[model samples]
Target: MPAGPPGKHNAQAGGLGSVPALGRPERRAESLAVAGLQPFSSVDFPGRLAAVVFLQGCPWRCGYCHNPGLQSRGPGAGPRWPELRDWLARRVGRLDGVVFSGGEPSLDPALPDVLDELRAMGYALGLHTAGLAPRRLAVLLPRLDWVGLDIKAAPTDAALHDRITGRRGSVRAVRESLALLRSGSVDFECRSTVHPAWFTDADVLRLVSELSSVPRHVLQLARLPDASGTARAPIAWPSAALLAEARVIRPDLQLRAA
Candidate 1:
């Protein structure tokens, strides 16, 4: 469940369709449009062995998005929610958790209900998001067990962030989400996917400094194109000096392969 593109998804925009109001359990469970499901994942939900649900539709269009197929709001080609639910029902105690990933899981109004269902079924819940919809996240906070929030760029560098996300006002939403997470009881972490072409050493340091209050911040190196021969640009890995300086700014910073 890697961070996907960010953009608003709604019925009018050809997204999954009209979002049902919160607390409407009758419709919420059926509203989800799942793009795919990873039956088992050890890395997605931190300590828990979990299943990752890839929801459809994201409003942003980051150039580095690997799941381009998921950026649209239309009906997906994967199993329907009911089918996935039935599948998960079978996993019960075998899986420790269920991670709602994206195409920005927060965009779907039904997410909270879906989380409710999963939690009731005895599975812990986790979310992966870019914080594009802070209000939605606020509603979801109480339902989540852990969250992996993506920090696209330094808070002050909105322009750079907009360029990466292909959308304006993203930084403001991310800031709001960060604030909410800071004040809440839920366990969470901030992560950044760094592509050397898009960020400099100074930028990384600044981003880390902005997240000083956060207990954990992870820096993930952008992935290289797969063997399918997709024409992705070559990646220049981060410099050791840059990583060292970032650690100085945020002593708890962790590095990982994307």
Candidate 2:
């Protein structure tokens, strides 16, 4: 089911509530504050037909973010998962997988159980994340079938990374998550959203060079900010020439238009 906005549900838990202890009272599934759902998607899960579940909350504030409404853990206008579940129940035969997307799916404590529920329902699990929560992701790794990881910038460039995420230590967390993915059995791809204002053509080349060992990498054009404002001058997007140069280093790189 698709979403409108969050209602009265409390979706964010303050702590990384430890994966529930065995003897504790059976917790009914925590309410997942789903920001939105794309009932069918082929692009999200690679080869499988999948549904996309956009969970709420992201610690980062990348300027080109299209889903700014999902940045806060506060009440949103998104759909509640219980209702989503009933709809999903009827879609079992039509969909082959489910992708947990963000506002950084790793930020929500309820995710592991959510994964378990979907797995039991015979759906393959996929996740899309910015890799801000390495510990959380490490715990969920074994249950996931595929992952789409967003690498914001080169791991060594902390300054640029922080500027993009508007948070400290985010790059370190991303690097650690990358390490975990490389060591695990899960199939995955790394992608980046590029803006000319934040990165030059040389920078893209350098970033791709660092990611040369990754099995797959994609370069996406960042969405330009709203054009209604008069105070800000519009920034030009990275050109096709830039993507061409990047493909030279990572020959298999994919380019996505804004």
Candidate 3:
């Protein structure tokens, strides 16, 4: 996502920390720039039958980010929110929940209203986020039923974390968001995607150590989708050694790689 217009903190805010949504007004539902939609997904929201709404616009430029096309703001490739609402209405008993994935869903100010509508329809709400905006997450926390937070790096390792995210100071905001999740009643899971090219075994160990207090943690090996081109050499999954090591740090740690 481009830098926030002046007065709203951008990369320069306090020099290299995740920028917060400061002084921004609430966005309207019509303002939702949806990038894509998966009308049904059994995996996105855990055990529930659900749909995935991919929102547009993300400030970070993580190299391993799969949805690079969703990085920009404005009208996305999917139907607008009004159309989505109509679709959701048709899904009443067929779906148990809706998961909002991103381009950092928290960046959309109209999310609170979106949550209200989902609640009225009696659908559980789940959010997948990098937690770019702590203030926004703090407000949305109460409305969330499940959250999947991407822990890109250890919070204190600002330089490396920023390097991984291609956005300076993002760790600060993630840490704040994690703290809010911990202090709230919401059920959340923290996960990090690892590619040997960017992360070492020691890095994973350090991350797990830092996340020891979280109730659930997942470690997923990055995989290029089928459309990404089969000509490239097959990538190795995260080593079982690494998973074993992570489990040592947190016995309950879950491995999301296959």
How does each model score on TM-score? 0.86, 0.84, 0.84
Model 1, 195-248: lDDT tens digits are 867887788888889887886888877764658954343355566777678777
Instruction: Write out the backbone clash pairs for model 3.
Output: 1-58, 16-169, 17-169, 18-169, 18-170
Q: Write the per-residue lDDT of candidate 2 for residues 76-195, one digit (tens) a residue.
A: 345555556655666788999999886878877778887887787798999999888899999899889999999888878888889988888779999999999998899999988777
Instruction: Provide the lDDT at 177 for model 1.
Output: 93
Q: Give me the displacement of residue 115 in model 1, in angstroms.
A: 1.0
Candidate with maximal lDDT: 1
- Where is model 2 poorest over a 10-residue stretch in terms of lDDT? 1-10
Worst 10 residues of 3 by lDDT: 2-11
Off by over 4 Å in 2: 1-28, 226-237
Local distance difference test, candidate 3: 0.75
The true-versus-predicted C-alpha distance at residue 85 of model 3, in Å, is 0.2
What's the lDDT for residue 15 in model 3?
24
Per-candidate alpha-carbon RMSD to the true structure = 6.5, 6.7, 10.1
